[model samples]
Target: MEIGFEELPVMNLAFVIDKSGSMNAADKMGWVKDAFGIFIDRVRDIDFVSLVVFDSSAR
Candidate 1:
């Protein structure tokens, strides 16, 4: 199933994450990435999404 982004209204999204070494444990990063991927899939192309991943600092 797919939602057409062209007809969707414009919106803003923000995704914050931790990229520290501890996040690499127990497949945490994998799970987070997977979840984010699925979530981003739901966003429309006309919308804006921001991904902010930080470990020791915000980049």
Candidate 2:
């Protein structure tokens, strides 16, 4: 089936992450960063994404 082009509703997403001492184990922190990068790349094609990481403070 063929579909027509149309404007969809806008969406906002927030990713809250904790970069505490526990996140330092098993390279989990690095993995998180990499995964975020990949996520940005993928979502960049469809929607706008915002990333927020929190430790003792928020960014």
Candidate 3:
């Protein structure tokens, strides 16, 4: 039995980050950065990634 596809589908990923004043507490921001780095490394070559950071408002 074979469980594979001839072509792989593209993936779209979005990451939302918090830039509020509290994020700096206990190296929280560092953890977030590390998580994002790992995610980028694991994504497929044909994948699309987007980032949205919000503190008071989103841009």
Candidate 4:
């Protein structure tokens, strides 16, 4: 039996990021950015991506 990759559904991903003062400690925020860059590069063109960042306020 053979599987059809084209028949699979597209992926939707949402990432919530923390931007508070604590995130600046020990370069935690830098790590998050680097990880996110790696992830976004691996996603297919058909995939959807959304990001939400929060600190004292969110936008």
Q: Which candidate is the best by lDDT?
A: 4
Error of 3 at 56 (Å): 0.9
lDDT of 4 by residue, 1-59 (tens): 77665655798889999999999999999999999999988778898999999999986
* Model 3 C-alpha lDDT per residue in residues 1-59, reported as the tens digit of each score: 75444355787878889989999899999999998999888787888999999999997
Runs in model 4 deviating more than 4 A are 1-8
Summed backbone clashes in each candidate are 0, 0, 0, 0
Residue pairs with clashing backbones, model 2: none
TM-score of each: 0.78, 0.67, 0.80, 0.84
Candidate 1 vs candidate 4, lDDT winner: 4
Give the winner by lDDT: 1 or 3.
Answer: 1
Candidate 2 vs candidate 3: the TM-score winner is: 3
Best by TM-score: 4
Q: What lDDT is reached at residue 41 by model 3?
A: 80
Please, what are the lDDT tens digits per residue for candidate 1 over residues 1-59? 77875765689889889999999899999999899989988877678999898999998
Query: Whole-model Cα lDDT per candidate?
Result: 0.88, 0.76, 0.86, 0.91
Model 2 residue-pair collision total: 0
Tens digits of lDDT, candidate 2, 1-59: 65433354445678888898899999999999899888776553456677778889898
